[model samples]
Target: MTASTHWLATAAAQSVLERGGNAFDAAVAGGFVLHIVEPHLNGPGGDMVALISPGGVDPSVLMGQGPAPAGASIDHFRAEGLQSVPGAGALAAAVPGAVDAWLMLLEDHGTWELTDVLEYALHYAETGHALGAQAAAVIGTMGQHFSEHWHSSAAQWMPNGQIPHEGDMIKNPPYAEVLRRLIAAGFDGGTRQRRIRLAREEWKSGFVAQSAVAFARTSHRHSSGSDHRGVLDMGDFANFSASYEEPQSINFRGTTIVKAGFWSQGPVLLQALAILDHFDDEHLDPSTAPGAHTILETLKLAMADRDAYYGDSASPRALRQLLEPEYAHGRAAEIEPTASREFRPGRIPGLKPFFPILTADPGESSVLGAGEPTVKISGETRGDTCHIDVVDRHGNMVSATPSGGWLQSSPTIPPLGFALGTRLQMTWLDPDSPSALRPGTRPRTTLSPTLLMKDGFATAALGTPGGDQQDQWQLLYLLRTIVGGYNPQQAIDAPMFHTSALAGSFWPREFHPAGVVMENRVSPDVLADLRDRGHEISIVDGWSLGRLSTVIRDPASGSMGAAANPRGNQGYAGGR
Candidate 1:
């Protein structure tokens, strides 16, 4: 079974499964297709995180997060007349890691060759695919900036000096050629694994790296309204490679909740679960007012801790202390029956809390132009990311969220046919902060994926794509599924809401104190109650919030189920 944000991508995964490929192969293929078909959301230049569980082995994370360049320091950014990294530009980019990570997973766990997995992506890029409405709309909205400031981006996305209309056949021959070169690099006469290693080396040191370095050295316009050159060079790319690590998980009720490590915002879901563990079954039902309120409050508290302690430098003991049952009960006790109107991070002994100043209201910030899609609906702008999930017959499961380096994020690197990611914007300039900008440190990334296991066997893979909201949406789905007894589809289809009260992980670092953005599908009574409880409420269209998708495998019966979000009218789920 395969579930992804785009039907064509899901079909690509299904085709891979039909060809005897395992979950890893299907996920890689689908991920590449996502880059081609969902260019506005993700690209080859992005970063990704995957939780992969081989049939009998333990689940591990493929950490695709790349670190800042050796020259990207706090003083350097401040010297550039910036209080924070610009939302979009060469300076905002880190070394691209998605391709490397996908190849790494394919080499270690997949059955297909590099060519086999890449063919689907190549076909869509070289021949053409019907342009998605959202993709076209995004390109059109950003057309003026691309045409006037980023010529390479305009040349690639705006054909004949005009934004392509929705459903138009768009082809990217340069990107196809880039993939072809990588495929050729892997042809160095050796075993499959050795060949894959050669490709990784080529990516780090060959023409791709050379082109990226050259592009980074050139000055480019940024969201800060100025031109700045990037500090990244070939050495940064050469020193970077995706790695494998154990996933952190916690048992909630009867099920185990798994997520990526502290480098990501993933653990916030686990932290929220620890707090909610104190609630009764009825209060956990997200379809009702009390349940939704408790969930939102708990999410806010967990997110506060996330901003305070979740980062690469965060200590394991500190994380353990935060997740401790006693600590959770203490934190839960702090949640007033009324909504919180302040940025309150809990205090843990020996751990200094990094309290970032709340700068400006998110609605007024003009520095909000990273990889997030700025779709206008009901006079408000919203953002988007990308996600994919797969489960093969062998019970091997993979969930990956590939995002950033969107076409709208920065100017395209002509030779590479993609742009640098704006993930560096996630880091702060404050040296005292855990997510502060530092040479060789991974930005506190928001790209998170989830895997569920039962009795030491993989049972489900679930995820979504919504910047800081990723874990919050996934948490809601898990609650409805594990606690409320909702099916995968039912969980995904339920009314979604999330608190944006914490400092956003994107550029501008905007925070909405006590803000609660929910779909109108939620009950009017519930919305009113939330408002009365001091939560600042903002209602959007019923389906404007989340794009969650999941695939579940039944170990006892060997049956698999899949579901995708109907919110965007693009996601799909399928199985044989």
Candidate 2:
């Protein structure tokens, strides 16, 4: 079974499963296909994080997130007369990690050759795939910027001086050639593992690196409304490689919830669960007013800590203290019937938490490139990242979120046919900040994927793609499924809400104290109750909040189930 944000990617993955590939092979194939089908959401130059449980073994995190370049420093950015990392342009580019990471996973766990796995992406990119409405909508929104500033992008996305409409067949020949070259690099009659490694070498040290750096060195318009040359160079690419790490896990209702470590926002869900564990099942239900309030407050608390403490530099001791039962109860004790509007990060005796400057002011909120570029920030949510989940009959399960390098957020490199990701915007210029800009350290990323384990076997894999809201949406699904007894489809279909009360991880960071965006399908009485409690409410359309997808396996029976979000008419799930 397989589920993904785009129907085509889902079909590609399901096809792999039907052809006897495991979950890892299907996920890698689908991930590459997404680079073609969802170019407005993700690309090869972006980053991704996956939680993989191979054949019911313990899950490990595939750390595809790349670090800052050797020249990326707060002092250098300050010297350039910048207050924060620009949300767009090559100045914010990281070492592109998505392609290498996917290839590595395939080499390690997959059964097929690299040529076989890449065929789906090559076909779509070389010929054409019908562009989704959301992708077209985003391109239309960025059309003027592309034409006026990023001319190469305009040539690729809006040729003939017109924006392509929904369902228009789009082809990216340059990217297709890039894929073909990688496969060609591996055709030396070597072992499968050696062949994939050779492809990775070509990517980091050959044409992909040279072409990207050369294109980025030219000045371009940034989200800050200024022109600047990017700081990335070939050395940054040559020095980085994706690797595996132990995933952090916490028990909830007798089941182990697995997520990536402090470097990503995955632990926010675990911390929220710990706090909510103190409450009864009634308080965990998101459909009721009291339950909704409790859930919102709990998320705000967890997110506050995320802003304060989570980063590549975060220590295990601090994480352990944060998840301690007594500490969670103490934090939960702070919740009140009325909403609390303060930026409240808990006190850990020796660690002084970093607090970002906040205001009711919406700073640069209207810039299309400043936040998650796919989201239509004009009060209605459209989209952001891309996600996929797959579970095979052999018990291999995977959940992956691939984001950044969207067309709107950065200029398209002419030769490579994709934009470098602006992930550096997540780093702070403040030296004291936990996620402060530092050469060779990873910027704290919001890309998160989740896995579930029970009785020593992996049971489920699920994830979504809303930057900071990624895990928040997953939290609601877990609560509904684990506590409220809803099936995967029911939990995903339930109305969703997320708080923006804490500092945002994206560029021009802003916070809306006590702010909540929800589907209007949430009871009007409950909405009024939230308002009465001092929560600032912005109600959107009924099915516009979440883009979650999930695939679950009955470990004992080897039976599988899958579901995708109904919102946006894009996500789909399928199986044999």
Candidate 3:
């Protein structure tokens, strides 16, 4: 079974599964295909997080998030007269890690050759894939900037000085050649493992690095409307490698919910669960007013902690304390029938929380070019990023979220045929911040994927594609399926809501006091109840909030199921 954000990627993954490939192989194929077909959402120069659980083995994290470039420093950025990293441009790029991470997963757990796994992407890039409406719209929105400022991107996206319409055939021969070269690098008659290793080396030290660095050296237009050269160099690429790490797990309603560590925002979901666990199931039902209020308040607390404490340099003791049962009970006690509009991170002895400088008011105009790359602030739906989940007959399961490099993120590196990701925007310029701009330290990433286990076997894998809302949307699915007794499809189809009360993870770090974005499918009475409780409500269209995908396997019964979001008319689910 396979489920993904795009139908073509889903088809590609399921094709691999039908051809005797395992879950890992199918995921790799689908991921590469997403990079081709969903260029407006993700690209080869980005980051990914995968939770992999082999048959009978404990789940582990494939840590593909790259660190800041060696020359990326708070002093340098301040010297450049910037308070925050630009949301778009080479100046905000980390070492590109998504391609290397996918290749690493393929090398470690896949049964197919490197060329075989990447063939799907190559085919789409060399030939052509029909562009989706969302991609076309994004191109149209960025058309002015591309034509007037980023000419390289204009040449790549606009053919003959025209934006392609939806359903237009789009081809990327340069990216196809890039894939072909990586495949060629491995064809030295060596062992399969050695061949894959050679390809990895070539990616970090070869043309991919060279082309990206050469393009970044030139001053370019940034989100700040200033032209500046980037800090990335060849050594930054050569020093990074994707590796696997132990996953953190917490028991939730008889299921072991597993996630990545503190470096990512995965733990916020677990922390929210712990707080919700202090209440009865009635308060956990998202469909009811009281339940929704409780969930919102719980998320606010968790997210406040995320802004204060989560980063590559976070203290482990503080993280453990945040998940403690007594601590959760104490936090839950702060929730009231009326909403609390304060940014309240819990107090831990010897720890002083870092409060960010918030610049945007919900009542005022937002700063231009400050929106996260994953989703549009003015759109009906939270979009960008690409998620895939796969579960095979053998009990192996994987869930991955790939995002960051978007067509609108930075100037297109003409030779490489992709833009560098602006992930460094997640970091703060303040030296006191745990997620401060520091050389060789990862910016706290929003990419999160989850796995569920029951009785020591993998049962499900799930993920979605909203920047900060990624975990919030997934939390709704988890609550509905685990506590409300809804099936995977039912849970995914339910109305969703997320709070923007915490400091924004993207550039400019805006926050709204007591703000909530909810789908209108939620009962009108519930919406009114929330508004009456002092929550600032922004109601959107029905079925326009989340884009989640999941695949489940019953370890006890050997039965399998898959589900995908219906919001975008893009996500698809399939099984044999």
Candidate 4:
């Protein structure tokens, strides 16, 4: 029931549920607290994306994706001969939208008042909490990133001038003051404060707002004779009006799905499911040693097709055949027990070998699990990201991935108390590709939030935090539960799969069907069968790929069940 990651985060979610708040409330609360507690993972500076279904209505996705400021580009970086921008500078910044989105949701959909929702977060920020093992672990590893910037983020994190260790009373008195100011005065004096103060001040029209002048006097500190006072103008925040994204629904593999993306991985997930419909899952269990091969082969086939045309819908290509049931059945039909990594289970020639990449050392662990490992960040940066799932009493679901982890490429706006996304970190430095490092292009993200509906009602709202592994985990967990018959926890806890789309490869490709890099513990005989089938197999640890977040609504009891990825020590879900 608590966010083991941090007591403050858990308390905030609990506060929401204790009142009349629903899944979205809990998530928003969690996100706010995440900024205070797991500051490195998420903050107001982050952007948020959520998949939500209220009662009988279809699901709606909310996008809080921040834009790459008025100007910024990989070309600019390359021109400067720099691979990446510093984490806390205008160069590394993205216009933040998570707070705006949360405020919008609170205004439009939430049942609770803004102050009610923020009370717990404000208290936590004001009254510090003891740091948890998880937070301490994240801070310890990310200190080097903190050291990069002499000012901004690098400074705030190392307060007391050093990274605090585990069990320390992590405190941020300045951030606490920021929240207090936000609650009382709002961003732009009494103007932005109207959202919260409107109810009380309706009788007093004589009150001309002077809070703006007050804020001006007390707001941001001038940056060392440097004009980089990154305080967002209240006008800028006031001008933000969330677009009414048309809700779209599609039936994929008999599952009624709804979302808010016309060009995101959400649609691609639908396409992947469509292709899966063509295959057989009747006896696809990994329990039977011999059967694991078919399971691995089937996944590989699905993944191959996923990579080829999973692009912006604007570009039409040959994909219908790939979705054809008979074709997928034929591809699955060709599976042999012993084959090379080249026998692609997909429609096209599978993903080419990763050009011999001098892999960065060996195994690198992320504080909150790794997202998009293969989707590398070439340059420089610092960041924070996290995921949360909530199921309310009415069986509604809210699944979200809110990230500030690293500002897509900007520094810490201290007064902002939020980190921008290093999201630009996702783009290819290449100036020519679709997701090429362009001036304003949003990266082709794999952070997809999904709400899987059955019988015209959302039965599951799920997603994962692994950048590229997101869709992969989302689809895998769904299959493992809906078809594979694993329980919610089992489905999430199960050893996940990921294709190593390496830089380059040849004689023995690593990104093939059945080409699995499994945890060393899976039965050797079972792995041997996968290996015999031409898979380029490697053995990793017990916990691996696709750390997922899921909420399952079982109609049988009208109750809910949930599970977080085992990779991270913290994740909690339950009905309000």
Candidate 4 C-alpha lDDT tens digits along 122-150 = 77677776665655665565566456433
CA displacement after TM-score superposition, residue 254 of candidate 2 (Å): 1.5
Off by over 4 Å in 1: 360-368, 374-383
Cα lDDT of model 4 overall?
0.52
Better of 1 and 4 by lDDT: 1
lDDT of each: 0.86, 0.89, 0.88, 0.52
Clashes of each: 0, 0, 0, 39
TM-scores of the candidates are 0.97, 0.98, 0.98, 0.75
Residue 206 displacement (Å), model 3: 0.4
Model 2 CA lDDT for position 466:
89
Task: Give the CA lDDT, 0 to 100, for residue 497 in model 1.
Answer: 83
Report the error of model 3 at residue 91, Å: 0.6
Q: How does residue 495 of candidate 4 score in lDDT?
A: 67
- 1-576 per-residue lDDT for model 3 (tens digits): 999999999999999999999999999999999998999889999889999999935899999899999999999999989878888888899999999999999989999998888889999999999999988888888888899888999999999999999999999988999999999999993878778888999999999999999998799888877888999999999999999988877898999999999889999999999999989989999999999999999999999998888899887766778888888999999999999998899987777888877644533112223345454333344246899999998999999999878888888999889989989999989889989989999999999999999989999999999999999999999999999999999999999889888888876566887889888788999999999999988887887888999999988788999999998799999998
lDDT of 2 by residue, 1-576 (tens): 999999999999999989988989999999999999999889999999999999978789998999999999999999989998888888888788898899999999999899999999999999999988988988888888898899999988997989999989999999999999999999994899999999999999999999998888898888878888888888999999999999988999988999999888989999999999999988999999899999999999999998898888778667768888899999999999998999999988788899988866656633465557533322366468999999998999999999888887788988888999989999999988898999999999999999999998999889998888888899999999999999999999999888878787777676888888888799989999999999998887888877999998888888889999999999999997
- Candidate maximizing TM-score: 2
